[model samples]
Target: MAKVIVYPPTSMILYDLVERMGHKALVVSEAVRNLVTASGIESPPLNVTPEEPKKGLRYAAVDVPSGVRGRMALIGPIIEEAEAAIIVEDPGWLTGCSGCSRTNELVRLLIRTKGIPVLDLSYPTNDDEAKVFVQKIRTFLEGLK
Candidate 1:
């Protein structure tokens, strides 16, 4: 099994789907941590305060807008550590937020520049909608096998 670190904005639906598939996922935000734990997914404490990259961890961000501002503050460490990143295309939150748009662009740039495989999950409202995203994640993890 491969070690996987899951980033923020992941709903319980998505988190449970990933964990139930027998994969390791780390929730990166306090809010997400609470969400995952509330949903009965075991999650470790992630110190996003310093925002330093954790060595030897493969990261999969849930969406382009990770709620962090500025390029360096957001993508700097994640890009350094991520083997692959999953971003939601046409994110539901981006519709009314200009900040999200900028963040999305930075995420795209980092993935492209680092040559990390980026799986676009887009918008998934239900379990069925999340299946394709889950499959993409599984496929990406399989390639590492």
Candidate 2:
């Protein structure tokens, strides 16, 4: 099984697709889950400190425009440990797209340097494209090993 990282910090489709194909989808929500569960307070809010950014550590304080360093604090650790990646983006997706272009570019650059197979896709607009997209993704994952 491969550890594939899905970007946008929140893409259920990519995450689910990875898991359904017998791969692990390492997403930010997992970190959020850890933070929430670590407090031992199964509640809506998590008690996390937003300290200075540090490499290989989770940074609760997420600042979009704080440059790549700040944004990396939120995702660098996950990228560092990822075996593969599936990055999907769509200009129409307001919420799923990166808020900062520079930060997005930095994330893509980091993914490229992971020396792993990456499936970069554009969100499908039609049913035909959707099918083809999924097929490509499945092919990419199967070829990973």
- Give the per-residue lDDT digits (tens) of candidate 1, residues 1-145: 3333333333344445445656543223433344345644443343233332231122334343334442234344545655555555665643222244555565466566776555666666689877876787677666643
Report the error of model 2 at residue 6, Å: 1.5
Q: All models: lDDT? A: 0.47, 0.70
lDDT of 1: 0.47
Tell me the TM-score of each prediction against the true structure: 0.49, 0.77
Clashing residue pairs in candidate 2 are none
Q: Write the per-residue lDDT of candidate 2 for residues 31-120, one digit (tens) a residue.
A: 666666774555445433433244323422345444445446657778877999988776255435445677677777788877888888
**TM-score of structure candidate 1:** 0.49
Give one clash count per candidate, in the order shown.
0, 0
Q: Which pairs of residues collide in model 1?
A: none
- RMSD to native for every prediction? 9.0, 4.1
